[model samples]
Target: MMYVFLGKNVAQNRELAQMLTQFQLEFELLTYDDIDETILNFCMAHTNDCFDLLTDRLQDYRSRSDISYSELCQLILSDVEKHIKFPLVIKDDVVYAGLTNAEARSLLLPKKVRFMLSRQYLSKSYHVMMARKKVS
Candidate 1:
């Protein structure tokens, strides 16, 4: 399973989809309507100390209107573009990619999932440290 968090910019998200297509990997685009406790935790685990901030933004955005749990996911994409490191590829095992767009695009889909997992653990990457417990 691959969950791709979408960006605010249509073009960027489209490009990301195209990039995934080029890699020949099928993925589902995660949008505001996908928010939930699990999705929130996923974004929180991926983000660096920004969960409260995101929640607050969602509250602020609610303003005078009601919002569903999934509707609240607008915060993750609109507020934390720089923090997104999606294409959370889950197959035989759980594996995470880098925080940057370039890294996620270039380093994630091409390499074997096992290789990425081992490389992350070998380097002791912070995300890997969290992914093992928090993401999976």
Candidate 2:
């Protein structure tokens, strides 16, 4: 599965990328500047209810200036860097945005456990034997 990650080229995004890599998850990273209208529109279409939260968060930017909410929304869509929350991950029709470390870990743990179990099975390791014993 191909995952889409939208964020700036910052430490948080970098960490997210690294975590994905560590889990051997395939993904594409799109920085805020790299997003265009087409991609934004697609995201909006596929985001379902998540778009509401995104728009609500975008409203926060309006408070920073005198621009009307509509104008601010337009500006944010045009230049997402101004309003984007980092480390947004889209995979398998689900969206994960601004995840805390615990959240990320919980999301990844299943895959990690599967990978580890596969490796242990292939190696026929003592750990695997012990695990089987515990299961029995």
Per-residue alpha-carbon lDDT of model 1 for 1-136, expressed as tens digits?
5766554666666777787777678666675345455655664455444333343434455454676545555545454444333333332233343224565655556568647756877888766787888866
Q: What is the TM-score of each candidate against the true structure?
A: 0.44, 0.58
Scored against the true structure, residue 34 in model 2 reaches a CA lDDT of 68
Prediction 2 TM-score vs. true: 0.58
TM-score of decoy 1: 0.44
- Model 2 lDDT per residue over 38-111, tens place: 65555556666434426355655534767654564476677576455555556666666656655775674467
Enumerate clash totals for all models, in the order shown.
0, 0
Top candidate on lDDT is: 2
User: Which candidate has the highest TM-score of all?
Assistant: 2
